[model samples]
Target: MEYSTKETSEKYSNITSLWRANSSSSSVIDAETSPVHVGPQNSLKENDKIEKLFGQPEGVDFKQYSGYVTVDPIAGRALFYYFVESPQDSASKPLVLWLNGGPGCSSLGGGAFGELGPFRVNKDGTLHSNQFSWISEANIIFLESPAGVGFSYTNTSSDYNFSGDSTTARDSYTFLVNWLERFPEYKASDFYLTGESYAGHYVPQLAQLILVHNNHPKKTIISTINLKGLAIGNAYVDFESNMKGTTEYYWSHALISDELYNKIISTCNFSTPSSASKKCNAYLDQIDEEIGNIFLYNIYAPLCNNRSLSSTSISEVDPCLPSYIQSYFNVPEVQKAMHANVTNLPYPWESCNSTLNLSWKDRPLTVLPLLHQLMKSGLRIWLYSGDMDVVVPVTDTRYAIKKLKLPVKTAWHPWYLQGEVGGYVEEYENLTLLTIRGAGHFVPTYQPNRALAFFSHFLSGKLLPKE
Candidate 1:
């Protein structure tokens, strides 16, 4: 789910033209695997259980399932998902769908393993429990959306080239509907959407689409997705605010010079055809020169060692853990356990897909309206940012909220965890602006305990404690 720092303004009207891949790659399909037909209600017994997780860690008592839900079977296209039931009493827990950003990144690899899933993948290719895992509070679902991300693939090659925000939303919704038919027990469960980074665009857009479909004329045919709320962390909500915030964050944090900042802010138009101008790019380059080799997502975190495959201790994961995860997911046993690689995909499992059309034609300049629309629908909306994240920094999140002008329901105050100041928040009508004290772009990975604490509160309709 990675996007270029620059944004493209051209909008393509024809959706079919977007996904034309080289015909040679996916023109064939196996006869045994036919297009899936939606089954009758309560006929979900088949996909309700996961056979194994290969080297699944000890002390895990939860039931988890991993498999593909056919999104467009004509294309033999399917999206992969990893669902973990809450360890203690999932029947009462809400179903939360977690997505990761890169626009093409793997949510299972990033969000599930690296952040809030029940377990984290060790460098040695073993599994370990994540005590702060979000599944501890709710039945978490991690989806590898759009064909070509993670194990999700297409037999019709063109689907790879045709992915964008709209298709992604449509297919993700389709996956949810079909997935429910396979597990009808959760059809009426309250759904809460969560994601970060480029998912800032994905989560809101999907929520907007779900809201629209909730009132479709033929509503009975479509299963009800009881959408209750959404939570986005270090998200890219608004382009102007994000870009302006990036520049301001660099300048304010002494990453850029006063002169360069002044020159770009004046010459660089945030509303450019590509969302960024040449002069703006040049100035950012200068800042890059000064911040050499540091992780932009978590400027203070230690870098991972690629060769030895070591980084942080078991306590905290290295941001580069994605490499280790890539190795882990590609294993035959792991794939078999996860019920993945059904058609023997041509390519290896990757963390960020490069085949996607980077010149996305459907991306909206800003998702602020979608956020507004969701809030107006009486959905619980919480925007949380990791203060240490420079990509979509906390300052920009605050700036975006200020622009929304939601009437303040509670004055700004420190929110506590374990008697310590975890962060600060200002509650607005139907929305909450929150900051995680020491986390980076991926809050769950960086500050797991606090992130889980914050999330537990958000999901339970309880505010972050003031003590």
Candidate 2:
């Protein structure tokens, strides 16, 4: 019997659920007790306004907007989005579309609130300004893509039951078309697709769609979306390399025993796991025992043991912060302020949609071909990895990129920011591979200041400064 990708993922979902399913509270406050108003339903363009924020965040200069763009009216499927203008320049900055990957995660929650967004969620379910928000250099848009993820949803229940890569990419492309129509002022904006994790698939696929539409605008009912480039961090580009690299990463880092590592590495290839010998599965099981209860995403980063606020590191955002994010989005006032969960969602918001089971039907194992096409078309392509991320470690990314066999344009060198070495960089014909030193899976959250410097330079077309 052939199992679907969703079925395959289901088998492993529980193992990966620790970080994702931190806390999902149905903490919606009684709206009757606390008035949360979004004024009238007859607002202007969906993309041009924010209903309101729960409370004003101090020192925040950029305007904020959040709402939904209807992708298919007949299906009643809409995508939720949060837009923030550049803090200083409203009119001149390029627009960046940011995505986060679970294959089914909320970009608004992860990217906008957790990583490089202007605001961070406080434990008290309040908002605070992130000094290093990516909006400093560009107009940023965070999308909760494909109905059933975050606030994006469909009236047709089957929409949630059936969704894949093609559905996702097609819907995202449609969302952009409708969004551009609503926010026409940004029609000619220099747009770039940015994301991390599975968005390695999302960015390239969406970029490909936009590129095709730009060439045949008349075919698309909407005008051309000016897609210029793409940047993805710790991206999932190749399946075999990622799986192989992650196992090796654990062994090399002393998380697994030498005997077990040797046995598994020699016997097991994830590419054909079903055909594995009995010894391979036996060793793999032993490897899992060695990896028990540790934070696999960032090998060096400490986990929040004791679950206390005091255990948090002041330098990086708290590991328990995703719980804060989930709780904040649960607040009735906050949801109303952002015009989210308007129909009163039956379930609380989560960082990753466990409710979704895309099974890999729409997923492409490798987006390398798309990346190659984009690079040849002269689009600036960047693949950055946080060196500390074991989940999608830099080793796998390096291996994946090396397969391109593109001649290097610049030798690998240290890139500096704030008078210190920030990371390392190597440039190819049209592609740049960068590594954020000491950063984890979520690079922006772990290294905010350095991440800002990295992104600001990328957006400005400045090469990473060799120090």
Report the number of the highest-TM-score candidate: 1
Give the Å error, residue 193, model 2. Answer: 0.4
Q: lDDT per prediction?
A: 0.75, 0.73
TM-score (C-alpha) between model 2 and the true structure: 0.88
Best by lDDT: 1
Residue 317: error of model 1 in Å? 2.7
Instruction: Summarize candidate 1's per-residue lDDT along 78-120 as a digit string, tens digits.
Output: 8899999998889999999999876777898888888888877
What's the C-alpha lDDT at position 298 in model 1?
Answer: 71
Clashes of 1: 9
Candidate 1 yields a Cα-based lDDT of 0.75
Q: Which pairs clash inside model 2? A: 6-359, 165-362
Clashing pairs in 1: 1-101, 1-102, 1-103, 1-104, 1-105, 2-102, 2-103, 18-162, 19-162
TM-score of each: 0.88, 0.88
Residue 219 of candidate 2: its Cα lDDT? 56
**Model 2 agreement with the true structure over 1-467: per-residue lDDT tens digits:** 00111222223222222112222121111112111111222444653466457755656566888888877777888889998988786689899999988777888788898889988877667777787888888998999987888899898987875576667887888788777766778999999999998788788878877777677624534567777889999987776567677667777788888887787678776554335567666665565567676555666765654554621232656766776777778788888778888777787777776546334344454667678888888788889988877778788798788878899999999999878899999998889999998898888988988888888888877777877
lDDT of 2 at 220: 31
Off by over 4 Å in 1: 1-48, 273-277, 306-314, 357-359
